[model samples]
Target: MDKHLTPGHVICLINPVTVNLSHNILVINCGSSSLKFAVIDPESTQVLIQGIAERLNSPDALLKVQPLGSQAIPYINHAKAMAAILASLGDIPIAGIGHRVVHGGEFFSASVLLNEDAVAKIDACRALAPLHNPAHVTGIRAAMENFPELPHVAVFDTAFHQTMPPHAYFYALPYDLYKTHQVRRYGFHGTSHRFVAEQAATLLDKPFTELQIITAHLGNGCSACAIKNGQSMDTTMGLTPLEGLAMGTRSGDVDPNLIQFLVEQTGRDIRQVTDLLNRDSGLLGLSGLSNDMRTLLEAADNGHSRAELAIDVFCYRLAKGILGLAAALDRIDALIFTGGIGENSAPIRARTLAHLKVLKPTLDHDLNSAHGRHTAGRITTTDSALTALVVPTNEELVIARETQRLLQP
Candidate 1:
């Protein structure tokens, strides 16, 4: 394998003489109510096109497609959406399809080509991820129905974090409960965190086995992870995504009794409480306005008391989580920021790193404002011990690479 010359950008220059697989691959990532799809070239590790079908099984469903070298096209429902996506492929002959399946449930350790047995194994773990797995199965089944001849593979989100040691993943609960129900911390954002950490390693001109870093994915669902020697030592999210940092609407960490308290006081059912925690909380709950951080920040700047408090709390929790993650890494080399809030919100980023002044994370005030996709540069000052980078996370590329690896014998 010939490595590309660019730093942090290496492409395996397969000579075709040693390869037995096809060049083109399609990656499918299905979420709770959405399906995200991509067509990629495994040789160059480039995504040619991408699309998403959102609000599936609902009336307000819509599909959006950004065709290869073209603008985005929006559609309605999964069936129509898939057809549009297929149409967007044009003459790009797809060799194989790889899917992103959440919660592999200790069954899948790496990307596996999908077969009847593998599909059944994925189906069996539905209870572990009621919101995600069903939609994933549905989307994969749709792909199977549409492209029966192509080889299909399943790449898991939880698979990357499987390297997490027992201490980091295990909960302080009964052994029987964990064994019987598979109740333990299965960190989400594994794909993104793993992808960026690898990117960090590449940028640092270091191998994964020699790097120690912290990756913060601060999108709607946020989490901090400590990666030591390319393995997840600890992550903010535990048991479920709801257990992490304050998100768009999901209340991050809450009192265990709060659920019971709300249920009894409001005379609501379990599902109602679940909706509140997952949809009506977080910045939305605190500000009582919007879940969006940008709008919250704007309002906060205008002297909106609740919005200010929400912003403060969000940054504080994020910093606190990073401190804990740093402790896990023992020594920090790079601190990566990705996702929506992490990449764009300079104020939020500043607030987060300001608390880490002792860690000597100096912001290149100018550079922080211009951060964007795939651009990883130093945001820290000259005197800082640790490096702060806005390394954009590319989970799709990670999935595509894993797909390529699985296809090769």
Candidate 2:
């Protein structure tokens, strides 16, 4: 354990009901209207089960639960879904519960065990993450109600980025506003980026502190981070999650004045504009079709003009973000791709990197397509100036590991 651990605060969760160090740790990751969970044993880091709750707060919300290496089973409501999920755990004793919380603010810099005061603290910051916090609160409450005997830990997405220096995090806003409301660039996807960066360092057999990395997490919600010395020097996401690479349904990096312009021109309410930006923008808005990249790629392959434009724009923004990140890092030791689109979409990866000719990143097309989760290899040509890799992010494992570490007495 690091000497920075607060005595009596970091609870050691070595022994569970049977005094055995090997215990099943439950990890829950909740978004605005979805909850993704996994169960893992600390002894081997083996995933025992995994599940997801989608469309929360909707009458037609659904959940898909799956045991380790098994097919998923869908359920109607989150409550019933959670019940079915718990029952599916069979007789496995739940040692602890770890939750992925969105915004931890300036107060929490590391993972902490959830108690009443901590829960209250989380509740107080609902305004900071209007979409994410309520769902997190709901999931945590459900977990508490269902398993009153277990120790629930809050593993924050913002925690890993806490190592960011003040210059990188602070905004040039009014002093009182920052001091009173905590308005600053609080980067999300810290968990995924941190996990991938560490994995990349290990794969390269290089010390983390010596590596300058730029990690692109390109899923439904996309973000890039500039990691220097294993710490977040800067990230694409700002005060909100809606600030990074153009996402599935988000208008990432839009002009701030556009909001006012749209409001004046369309005479629509702010809520409507917010909904448009958050729910109806990005690839879906651009392509005039599905938000999924695979669907867009298919449409483009079949001569869909809008889809082609959408793909081009997405890659353009991605490459630009990478360039910015590279500038932040001074020089890039490795450029890693992770997330749904990043890991699986070889064409997307190739297109994104092709624009980086100025940086001399040569992509080996064959390796990019062959690489998958658990396989880390260089996709860059031997003579390429920069190292390009495909690394799968493991945020769940980070959550479980943090839970075990914080709970260990």
Candidate 3:
């Protein structure tokens, strides 16, 4: 543990259950309409308390708290949600707070301790992530107001990917657009990508800075990253999150002209067209069923044609993406799978690996079937040149660790 940790406060995980009394890190992930809060031990990484306040600012809003006899209660606003979360934490000694900000744009290259300037910079980039940054600002301010003195840190999702080279980020647009408007690829889910990459390096028994890795985060919002020497070289998501692999309801990588074409054909405005692409497309659009991979997998097994197509496209795109990311590396050290679908879906991993025949990756049937959740985590046979691994990502833990590191005196 760092020398900064002191017996500042007593931790009460539950009435009967106790842990080593130390300062905690409170992590807040404020989404558009929901807020998730967790009180975590920065040293032990034990979550003392966690809850989500959903449907905020509405009469139906409720705070659903977890595991010490989980229950729900009325909490109708973001500010109140923050208060409720902290109040429930009770005697847990909170050393600092960590807030997840979705986009830092070109302003931040790493996790930062929030101050007036930092908050201002994050607010200025609100246009870059209108749906998320505003809520984040609200949460940060509310947390700040509630705690008053605890140090607050902003952990950006795009900060880890800011190391991407110019050629990797720049699109075929006027250079002035980048200079003036900062119009370029700023990958999303970077925290998850970076976290899993670090885990992959550990699993490979190599220093993070010495490895070249491709990490695919396959949750509702998906992105693949190519990390070389502990920094991002290239990533799939560009500008907005709508530019990568097909996601839950997001149509990734559509023709730039398709938005206008959609408007002309449907006689809808650009806003509706944008919403169509962002919210109504992707797996849902392809399957016309659920946007969930598990649902699609089961439906496909039951002979649902559209479900099969969705899964096929999803796997194909992922395979191509893993291969494409290799372009940014001198040599591939490991290919890591993380997030929801990546960690749990054995079928998806197996199906995707089948398309990587060029890599000559021999799938260890038993390991792959077990979902690679063990210590080895390798799904490929020993003879394969390129190995595949499933390293479950912990973005909140990354935020907590970053918060603790920056708070060190």
| Residue pairs in candidate 1 whose N, alpha carbon or C atoms collide under 3 angstroms | none
Q: Which clashing pairs does model 2 show? A: 11-407, 11-408, 12-407, 12-408, 12-409, 13-407, 13-408
Candidate No. with top TM-score: 3
Task: Supply candidate 1's per-residue lDDT for 21.
Answer: 38
Query: How close is each model in CA RMSD to the real structure?
Result: 5.7, 6.9, 4.9
Native-to-model Cα distance after best TM-score fit, residue 61 in candidate 1, in Å: 4.3
lDDT of 2 by residue, 133-205 (tens): 8778877888888888889999887777877777877888787888888888889998999989999999989
Q: Write the per-residue lDDT of candidate 3 for residues 295-338, one digit (tens) a residue.
A: 99999999999999998888988889888988999988888988
Q: Once model 2 is optimally superposed onto the true structure by TM-score, how far is the C-alpha of residue 244 displaced, in angstroms? A: 2.1
lDDT by residue (tens digit), candidate 1, 1-409 = 1111111322333344544335678888776666677676766666555666676667666655553232333435555556667876776677888898887888887788899899988988898888888878887888887889988888887887788888888989899978999898888888989988988898778898889999999987899899999898889987778997988899998888998999999999988999999999989999999998999999999999999988888998898889887777768988999887887788998899888867877677787777733345567765778788888777767777777787787
Candidate numbers sorted by TM-score from highest down: 3, 2, 1
The residue ranges of model 1 lying beyond 4 angstroms of the native Cα positions read 1-22, 57-61, 67-80, 372-376
The residue pairs found clashing in candidate 3 are: none
TM-score of each: 0.88, 0.89, 0.94
Model 1 lDDT-worst window of ten = 1-10
